[model samples]
Target: MNLKDFKAKLKNKIWRNVKAYFYDQRIADSTLVQNINLSTAQNQKKAIVSYVTYSHFNDWENNNIGRTQPFEILSMVKVLTELNYAIDIVGCHDLKTLDYLKLKNYDLIFGFGETFYQLTMLHPNAKSILYMTEHHPNFTKIEEQKRLDYFYDRKKKKANTVRTGNFYWDHHMKKKYTHVITMSETEPFNTEYTKPFNIFPTGILNNNFKLKPKNHDSSKKHFLWFGSYGAIHKGLDLLFDVFQKHDDIVLHVAGFYKDDRQLLEFPNKKNIIDYEYIDIQSNQFLEIIETCTYCILPSCSEGFSTAITTTMRHGLIPIVMENTGFNRLNELAFFLNDFNIEYIDKQLKEYSTKDSEYLASLSEKVFSFANSNFSIHAFESKFNVILNQILKND
Candidate 1:
């Protein structure tokens, strides 16, 4: 490794270990019934959001580094407070056991986790909302396995499946909810829940990125694959297979990969550039944004990828797999109807051959669409409407 890359990796490792130590210490001292109350009045209606409370515990304003969950969680609390409801926040994964007696008096239970499931069962009279951030667990499990099997068939080696559902299988089994809110298409949830589902667009960090002029003729041959974790599940392996064979096409990869060996297996391909982990706010990401014309991900499942949306906001025309919760974006994106190596290779080559004018126009459309639909303001407004409907039982 080069000196610069080696220093960055070492810095990241040290920071991660330090952060984990403090995080674990905080968890050890945390209490079961402790909550962050946001009530304007004493007699306001009470609601409990069983999601990430770490947003409240940290200096989120300054240390906003990864994912949109922290902002989304804070937005949910803000909406609940504005609705005249006293809100209590809990970390979904932090609790080993919940105090049922202490929580039974809450008028509403929202978000997803084992605690959400337990509360839904314990208080049948409460307004329970299941916030699904992914495809139904069954769908996710089956699809991830399918990708793993496909990888094994091609490579003659096994890789770990990293995209397994966070919520247990039994969380949805035979459970009824007052309303179901999702960030993706609702069709996948049909197999798991009979309840009505409401959809909201996932939010992206608007870095206020300004689009710059580019030579689409040159950039069109360059593609980007940006994601976090679950490299195989996000179809990075498939991308490696396609780009490595065709030196004419360049694939720029960003994001964390847990399986280093999976990366080592396909090393030293001149056509592929790996920028391991990237911050969207960094100059490295901006340089990549300027270099690539298309952002591609063939992920097996998603609840609307913010990764894709973020790239779209930066004027990268999206080329994504069909039915991976991107059906809503079909008009703005190029959809791959199949996931096989032959199909991907055929489609990508066809896409890269488009004229510069055509590529630029499509990129503008994608950027405008993403800015209109996937902003934090858009997410908050849509979520507010959904929450009101649930509260009023409309």
Candidate 2:
């Protein structure tokens, strides 16, 4: 083996040993691990097993971090149970539990990304489906990583680790899975069966999120950039550069920075306000959306953007890139062809010049699109259609 590979293996071995030593104690205290158990009561349909945390099923408990719990995982389990199928759910991290379960008995298996590998082990006959969340190498990985490296000041080692993990999962680990469900047509999923589920993943937004009769005076010329970490990945640096130059539109940032130094790097531009780390459940998060006319996210890549959908539900027009996982955003929102300051500046200027009536109309369209596309009802209906097909498949 090469010296680099040897060193990596050695480091991983040490890390694994440390993890194994604390595994039992940590597992005992983990809510996700504790909830990983076989379903009670037998049903009529073929047994179905899936890899998903039990906490994801609880709407109240969902933190909406990384847009992970787009829909309740248990909702799918409950549907299978209602259809008289026996269900078994295990935490995605509980690899050892696979040894205890009768893997061959399951007629169907559903999992996300790499979990499909473990789900398919010793069960070649079972139908398997992978929920595609990101595009892998040779598709958009090079471009995506290049953008991230340029924009985000993350450590090289950390970036390499993520790139390697994603590459291995999407390329090698996912090969055995036959089916894939994706949020966008452009996202590449190398599998025998691929289905494009176009709607962006829905979050906690409900009918209440629609800010009715939005006060045009206050909301006009206000924009928001809200997302979790990976500041460079989401193009926060590009945003800072543009927003600093143009004082016409007020930009509010609602996200956690990877480092305090990243925040300190940006000087106090008058038009920019930073409310670091706004919780989705908090009034501050809602108020930002209620008062903002547009939400901007020039992300390098995304499976689906929860922030964009959440903002849209609150009647905020989106200004994002094509690869941000919302296809045909030009219909109801501004689509950024490039993150260059010159192009963004020109677009911002155009938006600044738009009349309130036109902006209000766009806001209505945004709200309509979000409500129809990202609602729980929409997810449930679409999920049922897909699940029904899978259950009946030969």
Candidate 3:
């Protein structure tokens, strides 16, 4: 093995150990081994909800794109707590297929993305809330060509896995829940299609998105993208080319991938700053966004990027690509760009936060836009509306 690879491997091992040592599980140990039969408590004005996430604890902070479904659950839990209900969370399925958790006593589950679909089969009596990201056979059809692909530049990866063989994807045995939860009136998700879908986003602690006073070299502007880079939808390869021709500009990356990918080694760019492996979907990620100059996501596909909303919260000017379920791309998106380098470069020169005047213009509007539409209170109000309605009938 190469020396660099060996050293990086060592660093990864050390970092993993460090995180395990310090990352607080925040879970009460008393709740761990007890037999939790939520079904028995079924109608007690309390709920025992189960969440089946697309990701888990290891990836929750180990990589740059890492997020915590637990934190999201906790936010909803806090809301439900105020409403006088209790909830429990466990991995959707354990390593062994036979060990899946299924009991018919829970009230509702707000499961995310692909994991929600499979987990629904486990609890037929419980409400199955499918909160999914954009994917094939769901949002954009294969016929929408020339459009960018979110999974590693390949159109095939973004295709409907639900329709593929042995995928055995089905929803017949399981019935759709009365409520489907999602955020915004955007792409990859259409409230029209999934009626009674509630728009509930995670609430942000203001300090996390509060900006600190710092010196700015208004002349040396930066463009930003904060999300996972494992796939091409993040437009990293496109940035490699953009950096080649522009020596004055810089790129700030955060959200996923610990090390710079081999494809992002731009020769001419002054600097490439990376904030890898911060627990975003967790509560910590908001702090990172507040500290950033501005955040951008040129994703080829998205239902609604968590980073995009978080960035906007902290007054980071965002640049976005128009794609699946990205419909609410209103004032939140300041400088939108196509994936091609030439058009991007031209826009960057004109619109980037390169001067005090330009920064001032954007700064004035940033926080207000986020507060009005992206606050936790707003999320709770909408979500509770649905919960109240459901309970009224039940």
Candidate 4:
């Protein structure tokens, strides 16, 4: 391998190990920061953000190249800091009971997890803002169970629920918050909130790779499935069943699937190319974008699906499930009405048969839509507006 490829692999390996440690250990007592570089005015406001804490210690410049959470956490901190709040950040998995004596002085509580829940309950005078990055827990549980049942009916074996919400009771649907900020559409699924409900645009990394001309004649029959974990919940199984029957179509799979070995060993796996855990900045991702005309995801639930938007930024037409928080795409995307094998098979076949010029036009539209709505700048701008409104209303 070349030095660049070797470095990328090494960085991924190290990041995996770090994430595994955090997930496995669940370091609840560890604080990311006490008072993050703020002036210690006696009457200054204080806020606690319960989200990904490890982002503070990692390579900030490279955080955007993989998962969107690190960049998101850092951006939240920036906004809160500019609002004249001294912030403290904690990991979402920190579920240990918090000390009430020390935390009672905070003026605002943000983000999700046990930390947010405890603070919101203890400090009645503080403004509690729930930062929702997924669907409501009730909606997520029901949809995930339905997907699991469908998988069992097909395979005659039960699969683990991989994409369900972690804390159901901490959401705005179950409890009261001063304001709720979400990254997904929350109309019918999460209408329980009486406070101000704000939806922010999901962000995508700006890759440095040059865009290459796509061969739509060849790519019209090629499809890409890009997601992180939750292979079944994201409807990769449906893709496997459909693509296995049609040998002419090519499906390029990216992202790390927990069931990678089992899912990749399907009946006719020749047409399915698996590039596990792809970095968005890598040439491998660029090659996949050049070869694929469509990016398909039938996830049960999502918060704008950064994976889909990331693929769209590279000129791939999105084929996503309807009402899974991507309704904003309107006509810019092809919405799958059903997740069954027959329905998906029909849709993929019909989409593949479109003329090369028509498919290219759709690709350009998707690229433009994603570029306009899902950039990092868009996320920061929308969030700043939402935060200002929340503060001004108080």
**Top model by lDDT, which number?**
1
- The better candidate by TM-score, 1 or 4, is 1
Error of 3 at 191 (Å): 8.5
2 against 3, candidate with superior TM-score: 2
Q: What total of clashing residue pairs does each candidate reach? A: 0, 0, 15, 0
Cα lDDT tens digits, model 1, 60-157, are 56674567776777778878878877666766654555653454477898888777887777777888888878766667788889888998899887
C-alpha local distance difference test of each model: 0.78, 0.65, 0.51, 0.77
TM-score of candidate 1 on Cα atoms, chains taken together: 0.87
Specify the poorest-scoring 10-residue window by lDDT in model 4: 24-33
Instruction: Estimate, for each residue in 1-394, the C-alpha lDDT of model 3 and write its tens digit.
Output: 9999999899999988786665465321222111223245454433444344332233444444334244555455666665555455543333232243343245555444233444555555655555443332333334133333432363233422211212112342134555555553333234344554535354243443445543345422665666664434456656655666765667766655534344334344455656565554556565444344566665555546666666666667677675444556565465454666677777777664467655655654766666665665665566667666655665
Roughly what TM-score does model 2 have, to 2 decimal places? Answer: 0.78
RMSD of each: 9.2, 7.2, 10.4, 9.2
Greater-TM-score candidate between 3 and 4: 4
Which 10-residue span in candidate 2 carries the lowest summed lDDT? 155-164
Better of 1 and 3 by TM-score: 1
Clashes of 1: 0
Identify the candidate with maximal TM-score. Answer: 1
Candidate 3 has its poorest 10 consecutive residues by lDDT at 159-168
